[model samples]
Target: YYNAIMACGLDSQDALEIFRLCIYDKQFIDTATLKDSQMQLKGRAASGVVFVANAALSVASITGDMSVVSEVITDLSSIGAKMNSESIRHIVRALGNIGDCEMILALLICLRGQDFANDLM
Candidate 1:
């Protein structure tokens, strides 16, 4: 749930505060909570594609969970999300935050079909 909130592009400080609160009460935390967050975020129809892509990268940075990040990326691709050079820059920064070489490599592979390679170069 905390991860998903951060993935919604909330400010880092706000997300951290919510994370602490959620951790303080473990009784209501469950897998369904995570699913709910994802559903809610995905249901947002007005957000830009770049925002959603960055949110996915933020999720990767916060949780270090590849599965959730992969799901977000896959969903974005499936929806044909429009990402520009700026979005790539933001994702690179988030990847730096993750500091996982394997994840970076995986992202590279996952993005091979996208048009941002030139932007990355």
Candidate 2:
């Protein structure tokens, strides 16, 4: 599913479906499943991450609810140390894309007092 998104030029809609499936489906059993799809996003060269990030934003845009977006950001922020740089960047970018004022503030608060500078900034 992730690979398919990349093959399609990082199709946001497809990526969103993958994100929804990961969240709603109990059948998906993998370490990556727990992480936001954005966290696993790769660049255009890598492709996978690009689609996943686009998908997340598309989902947020369509729903107008921050549930999925917040989950991804919170999960990513909480587990920032465990993720790679690219993953963390994607997670942050996802948050930024959502453009939710409340969520952005909350994330900022959570980031406070943390030693890691890159994830929050």
Best by TM-score: 1
Question: For model 2, what is the C-alpha lDDT against the true structure?
Answer: 0.46
- lDDT tens digits by residue: candidate 1, 21-87: 4433445434434544465332223133434345554645554544444555555565445545544
Tens digits of per-residue lDDT for model 2, 18-39 = 6555444344433345453445
Off by over 4 Å in 2: 8-10, 30-87, 91-110, 115-121
Clashes of each: 0, 2
Q: Estimate TM-scores for all models.
A: 0.41, 0.36
Worst 10 residues of 1 by lDDT: 41-50
What residue runs in model 1 are displaced by over 4 Å at the alpha carbon? 1-47, 82-99, 102-115
- Compared with the true structure, all predictions reach lDDT values of 0.50, 0.46
Q: Pick the candidate with the highest lDDT.
A: 1
What lDDT does candidate 1 reach at residue 114? 67
Model 2 CA lDDT for position 37: 44
